[model samples]
Target chain A: MERSTIDLWVGIFVALGVAALLGLAMKVGNLTTSNIGATYTVTANFENIGGLKPRAPVKSAGVVVGRVSEIKFDATTFEAVVSLSVDKRYVFPKDTFASIFTAGLLGEQYIGLEAGGDDAKLQNGDKIIKTQDAVVLEKMISQFLYNKAAETPKAPETSGSTSSVVDALGANPLDNTTVNTTINTLDNKGKTDIAQPVAP
Target chain B: MIRSKLLTSAIRTLRNIGSRFTERIWRMGAGARLFGLIVVSSGECLRRPRLVVREVYFTGVMSLIIILVSAFFVGMVLGLQGYNTLQTYGSSEAIGVLVALSLVRELGPVITALLFAGRAGTAITAEIGLMKATEQLSAMEMMAVSPIARVLAPRFWAGVIAMPILAALFCMVGVLGGYLVAVPLIGVDAGAFWSQMQASVDWQHDILNGMFKSVVFGVACTIIAIFEGYDAPPTAEGVSRATTRTVVTSSLVVLGLDFILTSFMINI
Candidate 1:
């Protein structure tokens, strides 16, 4: 084979190889996205979202059914309007309750929809009226601690707050008074133990 | 007298710098020609299976054992380190995911390419340089035989074919390594680790990306080495210079290709 011909063939092969790899990658990616065909959009209103961010999974009965698409608050209601993308085909009854659920003990919070009665299926953009706000574990723990503290009673006070304790120690009562004269103090100093023993 | 001496010195420095710049330009031009020669030669070699097979055995298969061993240990270390971090959050199962991702995405291809560049790149440059110095290529042209088809083509093809296989081996070994460390050492169940690894990783993209990077690395190594070799000046000193340049250039190309491949593959 001619040298130039060979270079041409090699170049072709390289291009073909890249094309094949790309096609395979696209096929695989499509397979993953297509498997769960059913998707629905559900909205939840929260007074506070806390750390609940978008792209968080929307789960139903512990299985991830969709993801939170957006989070914003309405000007009139002053409530967070979180749009969740649930799989199509999985029908949400009209009275279904949407609540934020946390995975594990400290994992990211996601939207969890509980199936409700009422045979009518929820349409797109329909408001899920029954919505529960995010239950932050830390906040709950702090509240529990506060309630426990409130339940506890204070101990009763004792009589000798200050002065009685000082009297019990047997200090002289006249020395404690401000009215004692300087002459009275001088007389007691010589007669009592307050008088120093003078040696010859 | 002082002015004359200063003028002479200035003239000498200018002449020296000018010659050095010209020399660098010549070397670069020659390097580029050599690269073209390798691509041409590799094309020719594709028609001759015997020569290509011999080169593949020496360049590709021979390096497999060491590559696999390195990959295994790398995976094990990744698993050990990842387990420690994930353990704090009670998500130790992520150790497998970490190990597999690291090996397949980065370590395997980069390490194998570097090794191939050091070994195959050096050898190609030296062999081609020596051939050029001895006028074998000129002799082949005199005989109406194309040297590029027979010599350079095989090396390039071998590089392209060998890299992905080596990387795959690297990834496989790494997973086993991770298993070795995670299961017995860290008390993780083998079943759980393997299952988690399979579930978490998007296997198609990860494996395909690794293979894609390897082929690119292979082409880069082959081209750089061939370029340096074929472009070498017609002296023994030139051959040595070519060999050094081949190793340096190929290593840089491999790293540059890796960065580009990573950006495209992971969108990072």
Candidate 2:
């Protein structure tokens, strides 16, 4: 057979193969238009959103039921309002409480919906009245420290070198000064209690 | 002293301009040859039926499996990594978007093309170089056969036609990879990943742009390899050099072409 004859067959086979693979990719990429499931929306209000973002998934009983679609601040109440898109099939009781939950340490955050009693199914656009504002761990720890600092009495000016102890450990004593300044700044900015050591 | 300094400056400027002009001429000559070669070969393909079948097999079908397998694993990794990151923020459901976007935009086409370049590009370069070295190309001329039509046309067309199909296959495998890993391994429901992906991707222009990039890559690789092979040195060492140049030039051109096409398509 001629080399040209061989080339022609090769081309046909390749074209067919390419077509098949494309079909497979569309299937795998979930690219077909009909596959997307149903969606429903729920609303919630909080004093501070604290960096909640759209497209964050909303979970109930550890199962992801929907996503946070929008967040806007209500001017009248100065409250942060969030709209969540839930799967239509997941019905929530009327008194459901919603909280903004952060994933593991250094993780992305999302909304968590807890079922409540009242025997009424929450409709689309129905509000989740009981809501918890986002909690920041760093803020809470700093607040605790600040309160402890206020309760403790200050040391006298004659206090023997606190720097001497750090020097004994072969590290920079000025590090302590920097740390103290940072703590002072955090206390000032947050208005929360900063933990301080009590002098005997 | 002043005269010498001026002479030195003039020499430097002339050298710079000369080098620039040389590069420009080199590019223009190569481009013209490629265009002429494509026109000649494509015309031959239209005139004859046998060449088309060979091209379909060599350029298209021969490469199908590799593209599909590579695409699948790439997709799987995308899903796993994306899900982990999103999991941290409780956005694990967006794994679909991550997998789909990456495959469509960058990974699928580039990887498929590179693999094709390695398989088809190397073989074509070797065949042409061997033919040239053995004087078979000259013999074809004696027999009244236009080597460009008989040889170069089929290879060029193969590259042009095969690349997109391979890329599409690669993309499909990748998406499947993502689904398997995300849904079963990572616990994302199959419905959610599929749904999110469908909502995020816009097929019309985006798919067109990606396939267009693949076509460009295919043409560039084929032309570069053929050019090097056709002009290959007479010795065994010459053939080796031709092969190396073909691979290096094809890979670089593919990447460079990708950047240019992507920037033009996205306006970024």
Candidate 3:
């Protein structure tokens, strides 16, 4: 081959290589998706982060607005201090709730932000006070079993006690606080109603 | 008399083993010295960019067809196999992620290096060995020319430059091949296939690490080829033997280095 021919082919080869790397970066990799520019960092403390890893998505209303930058164990508080790199464009209220949530039935864990009604916006380096820990499957199952054992002795006294137990069992694990409160109210109402009938 | 003979034969066997071990270590030392000389004289290779470019044409441009063809077939196989398993778990949509991650993380760099070793590496060894056998390298030295700078350095730099490019092209082509098999052939949703891959495969972690691996493999394969050729006995049979050794040694070193690199990259 002539000198010019060799140079031309080498040029083409280098160009093709460069193009391929660009394609990998834009098309096959997360460079396009996870480029949250100009981020402000905020920290949240959780009693348990479960499997929430760094670089995990930080989503608000199912849309990723940031990423989990770092996770450190707070020795003083005995909690997980998770640093979130949220996009500067989206500002959250100071009282916003940060909770660890799984994507699907058995998927990776992420941090979800639920905006609360607060006049003040969360600034950079601000700590989110209202943070919920990840719901451990073992803990939820054990809690259900314990509730069942406690209700077994009073099963015969209530007319619609079985339905209440089913409600507790079917409650959403993600909304642990709301479910626990609802179950408590239902139990109290059942006890008061059964007591009135027995008085007669 | 029988006991004495047995002891003599045993001692002879031990001596043979010890000699072979020392010979291997001596060869390793010689190779390291050659590598140092190449690095020291790399300025000459860079000063004349055309020499490196010419070698790049011979090694990289020539090896393109085999690299691309093998990558496509490998990727298609990955898609077919991945879809077959993922569909059972109702996650056929994730076939793209599986293909992209595996290609970027392991297959692209490793397979490209293996193919390059078979194609360009053997050629380099044979060419250099033949030059030695023909006394051309000795003639250059007689003419006050550093053959390491004029010949081996250009080829070494060429291999180093070409490797990552070939691996990148391999990755791109492989992903396209997988896309063809998964989306149109197997009826996977194209959007989910691409979206999931983009969501999962981090560029810094996967793509850059893979490029780094290719560069390391390039250095290893090229250096071994050049060293073997330079060290070969100046004979026809010696040239052929050096070529074979180049392929074997390059393949083994590439695999071993890949494991070490992967372990280090994963921890990060």
- Against the unseen true structure, what C-alpha lDDT does each candidate score? 0.73, 0.77, 0.94
Q: lDDT by residue for model 1 over A13-43, one digit each (tens)?
A: 4454454344323322222542456566778
Q: Looking only at chain A, give the TM-score of model 2 against the true structure.
A: 0.61
For candidate 2, write residues B103-123 as lDDT tens digits: 877887788778887888887
Arrange candidates by TM-score, descending: 3, 1, 2
Best by DockQ: 3
Interface RMSD of each: 7.5, 3.8, 0.4
Error of 3 at A71 (Å): 1.0
Task: List fnat per candidate, in order.
Answer: 0.00, 0.41, 1.00
Q: Grade the docking of candidate 1.
A: incorrect
DockQ of 1: 0.04
Candidate 2 wrong stretches, greater than 4 Å? A1-200, B1-28
In model 2 chain A, the worst 10-residue window by lDDT is: A164-173
Write down the TM-score for model 1: 0.62
Docking class of 3: medium
Which residue pairs clash within candidate 3?
none
Q: CA lDDT of A162 in candidate 3? A: 64
